[model samples]
Target: MRTKEAGAAMDSEFHVQCPYCGEELDIYLEPDVQGTLIQDCEVCCNPWKVEVWWDGDERSVAVSRGDGSE
Candidate 1:
């Protein structure tokens, strides 16, 4: 994983597979922003709930099925 500064926010990319469609995708994340967001797969049109966080010096992301529920 690598990070770059994009405007006022720090931009990073995370590689993950869609849970529903198993499509590989790259998710752009901001380390300064910590929260869960809904992202749709470009290949399958399935939604995924992505959680972004920091683990010490590295950034981490987790994905789950996005059914519009918290």
Candidate 2:
């Protein structure tokens, strides 16, 4: 029998932190999204307003923060 794989090859969620409270949070990565992906904090419940710029050629993500409120 073929065993099931626990972790997938590509992770849908990326690790992040809250800009307001500095709390750890997870941001989902859309498969089709090849640009900035804004994210919010779950623990602190704050709007981080993140920006993830991804290079289509290099296939990399550069995360940043925007105007957000706690």
Candidate 2 stretches greater than 4 Å from native:
1-11, 34-38, 56-70
Which number leads on TM-score? 1
- List TM-score per model, in order: 0.72, 0.52
lDDT of 1 by residue, 1-70 (tens): 5455443354477889888878778888764767788888888887888888768756788888898643
Pairs of colliding residues, candidate 1: none
lDDT of all predictions? 0.76, 0.54
lDDT of 2 by residue, 20-69 (tens): 67766666766456555455566655455555454553234444455533
**Quick one: best lDDT, which candidate?**
1
- Superposed on all Cα atoms, the candidates' RMSDs to the truth, in angstroms, are 5.4, 5.4
Could you tell me the TM-score of candidate 1?
0.72
